[model samples]
Target chain A: MSMHIMSAYDEELKYLTRRISEMGGLAEQMVAESVRALVNSDLALAQKVISDDTVLDDAERQIGEKAIVTIAKRQPVAADLREIMGSIRIASDLERVGDLGKNTAKRVIAVAGSGIPRKLARGLEHLAELALVQLKEVLDVYASRSPEKANSIRERDEEIDAIYTSLFRELLTYMMEDPRNITPCTHLLFCAKNIERIGDHATNIAETIYYMATGAQPEGERPKDDNTSTLGSVND
Target chain B: MNIMSEAAVEKALDQKMNTVPYKMIGKDVSVYYGEKRALFDVNLNIRENTVTALIGPSGCGKSTFLRTLNRMNDTIENCRVTGKITLDTDDIYDPTIDVVELRARVGMVFQKPNPFPKSIYDNVSYGPRIHGLARTKADFDEIVETSLQKAGLWNEVKDRLQEPGTGLSGGQQQRLCIARAVAVSPEVILMDEPCSALDPIATAKVEELIHELRTNFTIVIVTHSMQQAARVSQRTAMFHLGNLVEENDTDKMFTNPDDQRTQDYIMGRFG
Candidate 1:
């Protein structure tokens, strides 16, 4: 609630917070633009999303090094220690989110010449849209330091899983309907899986924020809804 | 508070309370130096074989409370302590109790190395000799050797037992003082900023020695260094403005202290 007595120490921690916010923005942009590239078949936009991922990587590295230096110099305790540790954990998760976005962008090139059917593109769009919302909301939760918002984000994680499970079945059906759909459908399945993983990373960040604010892990395991693992049949 | 974590913490505390016995208990302790009151109604318990740290800013009664443990305050002309302090159910402040014997059982090591100008052997042997802890020369010899060993200084000082204690490095002198305290075979060892005057390496050695000594003795340390308290003590008690703020396990106290005052004080947010 109060600033540390040393102004420079406060400045160091503020720098960490500002860097995390910037990295969050970059990650969100990558997810958004990669999905847009998929819908529009824009090779240039897909390339831009891939290139932007390195920036997130750099931000994560800087945050990690700064966190270590702050620990050595300040020997912070209580909330300060938790805040730094949370920053490291969240940075790492966001970096993985960046990789997922890049992987999805690479899939865009696979399906680009194959001319994805509008219906399949729309389904992938919906899945990406849900994951992006989660990413943005979890970042907002970090900015606001609200456990309520974090819990809400966690509860909504299953929505992405549900959409992904349906998309998995839909892609399978398209491949079965016609052999020509196999090449593009397989790539789309991977893209869908990548988007689903982004949702999982968003939940990871949410859990970190909850711990940062409350100094305690969220009780019980998150109610996982990714039923795709057991979906042996589309009917299931 | 998170409900699950709170439940775990409560359960852990319940188990600790049921299992760990108190080495000393002080109840409703208040101290006065002439007309000036230095301590309020403070109640604290020292757990057996555990290192308990007393921490606070200057003039906050941390040292005063440490002194009260061995009735060191009694040496001050106008100082008067009113409380029930017990060493295993024996009232320490009772009129019939011998202050000298009480001090022997609860030995003290001060901030400065206050070893006498005598040889190192003499310094370590002084307490045991006066307390009649050993009779034969061979017995005193073994006691001196083992005391230094317990203090983690025997390897360095065994060959030079007749050398003057003050001639050793600052850290060695402090360890010598600890060796002297150990010679009395005290039940509880009280250290008041014992490493403040030593270099970092020496300070680290003393800290390491404190950790090792915990298996045998109940120690209460008064320190200005929060890191030292966090490092060496199993439990830590924070004092502020002559009042007991809170005392808890060292891990809990440093990571997530309950009182805001303790948090601010540990984090250097207190003005």
Candidate 2:
């Protein structure tokens, strides 16, 4: 974050980074709160998570507009250009993270008061814990401008996806075991998917941070372990 | 400090092998003014019908390297340029070469819109008339029309061709200067921040003109604006502290320059 000879330009860029960091903070909070609500069946807290998403949405819009203005005014090039572009991209990903958290919260209301299986709830909580960790670490990478940390965060996504695949299989087994468990297990399955998607959005942020730090897109293919979509029927 | 062999550095820079014939070539070029060296061993190739941009911080020798192309530096007392500069295989600095003919073949536009005090028509016609490029009145008229049209200022000043060239707005005057340079049918055009004195809209128009003019003539532009270099040039050469730091494709140079000094300068971290 070297200052431009024009201090005003430096201030504008700093403001842009600050707005993105604020959005990241809010997205991470929503993800954590939504999962807490789901695990505890706190319907009011879930509703709170849903309503708080607008803050992230507003932050994203502001960042986008600010980035556009900064570009128009400063006409940044090279690393400065990358920094502004990275802010816009990271803001969008954080907004998606907020949406995913909101969707998870909505599912909490859908399955409220149903005597959920303790094991299924715990499985979802485990997935949320991992996703929340990824989200937090990726945010740290961006804040610190640490490409190495971003790379590690990107690599850890596969572990989250693997856990999600296992969760998907366990939920499918529960649904097949008892006809009564079908409704709750299906909702829990979606919750697990939402958490998995949160992991993905975190990985997207990691990739963006890497680009911002190095001025080049991360080389090679991203490690992917999400196999839930490819799973066939449990009868097989 | 990281040390690399010259060949290794050159390979890492990924200099593209130019296939087209060069309009101008400078080999082992150096410049000095009374013991103060301004450039050192700079080698560059100006491709035919392509826009090559020279960019660097102030006093980084970009303009000096540009002046060497057409030997503009020869005008300054004790400003000595040592090296070989060839235009279509003819030595530009040869003692026998006529500097006037060399300048007619290689025209230049400066930072400010310096139109002669004469009428617009006279400004565009001056070069052809002096160079004996037009034999008839019809030829003079035709050259004026075509140069103005190619400079994208034909319609704006056609009715006002009788008006003084300095009477036009800043942008129009700049365009008029460009038309004047084009009037002689120069093989190459050297623009040194031709749009610096213009407004944004005017700058855009001149930039568009530069893009169009490249089809008929080779162009070498020196600009302080990096975005302009990116937008207008196919090849970019970065100069730093009297050294040719890197020369490569414009996209590569801007996005991921191989030289750390180039990266630092583009990133605004260099002093």
Candidate 3:
């Protein structure tokens, strides 16, 4: 926890931490704004979310490049090496989270002018809220360097999965009840799936934080509850 | 702070069953130069057929520990050592043990290429000649050729076997020293910064040779370069201020060493 003798190395590591935080914050905002764009059918906000994803991609690329240069220059070992590698992995996951948010924003465009049912939007809003909380908490866990908080974050991913599975069922039932609902319902379904995947990316970040902080992967299976796979087809 | 689990997982996944056998064991090993203690109550083990790297900042007793393996410290006046260092079942420092024969079993290569001012062939055959391992001229020729081949220097030096070893390039001289050490067929080879005096290309060749040599001889290397330790050794031990801070698989030592001192030292955050 002391500064590196070559203070420049300490600065590079600090720069990595700061970049990851900035990237995490941007991803979180994109996911949240996309959900808000979906619920209110706000076209401009949805466009802004789509445009903002490129920034996350750029941040990821810059962080990855900087990490490689630092490795070449410092030949860092021990925790410094772990921190660099973790930043690369975490940046990758955050980039995917940004992409998922952009995917959700595209759905907002598909459902923008259409009259989406209030109940359907409500389910998606709840899913997005839960996923955002998970994303926010994992980023905070990474910043705090507390492996203990990472454990609870991973265990709670099952809760997000449970919600997503129920929402999947709900969306299917809505489609079946009215054939006219199929067109708009499919977009909402994709949006819900994207939000669910954002939750999964949050879990991935949590595991990475655990490894980065403690240098050991979290033990045991990661208690996944995404049972949508096991359910019989929509006919069932 | 255990970081071996990931490396262990990879090994388990690969289904590798490399049961490590200890080639040498040091227990309560302490070294003193008259009144100053250089090492304090160290307990460490060297794995058979593996490269064990000893690393620390200067004056941290890494070299002192390396010397204790073959009793190189005994040559220093008033230097006393009290502890058991066993090479197999024999205490290397015991009164009845022959230091000369022990050194042949545990040969060394120094930081600088210190080949004797003799023909390259004699420089390598010198150890075998002294030990009388070769009975005939043909036997000496075979031992010299094989030692050079094993040291990865034969291809460059085969045509000029009688030339003075000092005439070759720095890297070639270092490889010649390695060939000389290999000539004795030592069970354990001790290297004191074996690449410190060579260029990067030469250092790389020596590193590659060290990897190949692990099949035949257990090696203990004392080095100041953390990158070299990370690259060449299977197991790594960190010494700081006369104490062993952490020892672990090289994979873990470079990425996630246990003690704070080990991490700080490796990361150039030494206090």
Supply every candidate's count of residue pairs whose N, Cα or C atoms clash at under 3 angstroms. Answer: 0, 0, 0
lDDT of 2 by residue, B1-271 (tens): 9999766775665544356678999999999998999999999888898899999999999999998888899899999999899999899999999999999999999999999999999999999999999989899999999999999999998898889999999999999999999999999999999988999999999999999999999999999888899999988999998999999888778876778777777766634
| Candidate 2 runs further than 4 Å off | A233-236, B1-20, B160-162, B260-270
Question: Using TM-score as the measure, what is the rank order of every candidate, best first?
Answer: 1, 3, 2
Q: Model 3: per-residue lDDT, tens digit, B4-40?
A: 7766788874343246888999998999999999999
lDDT tens digits, residue span A159-188, model 1:
889889899989888898999999888988
The TM-scores that each candidate's chain B achieves against the reference are 0.95, 0.93, 0.95
Q: Which lDDT values do the candidates have, in the order given?
A: 0.92, 0.89, 0.91
- Residues A128-232, model 2: lDDT tens digits: 899999988888888898988888888888999999999889988888899887887888888888889999999999999899888777766789998877797
Error of 3 at A78 (Å): 2.2
List model 1's recovered fraction of native interface contacts, to 2 decimals.
Answer: 0.61
RMSD of 1: 3.0
In order, what fnat does every candidate score?
Answer: 0.61, 0.42, 0.89
Candidate 3 local lDDT, A119-211, one digit each (tens): 878888888899999999999999898999998999998888888889888877888999987888899888888999998898888999898
- Output the better candidate (1/3) by DockQ: 3
- Tell me each candidate's i-RMS in Å: 1.4, 2.2, 1.0
Judged by whole-model lDDT over C-alpha atoms, candidate 1 comes out at: 0.92
After superposing candidate 1 on the true structure, give the runs of residues whose Cα lies further than 4 Å from its correct spot: A233-235, B1-18
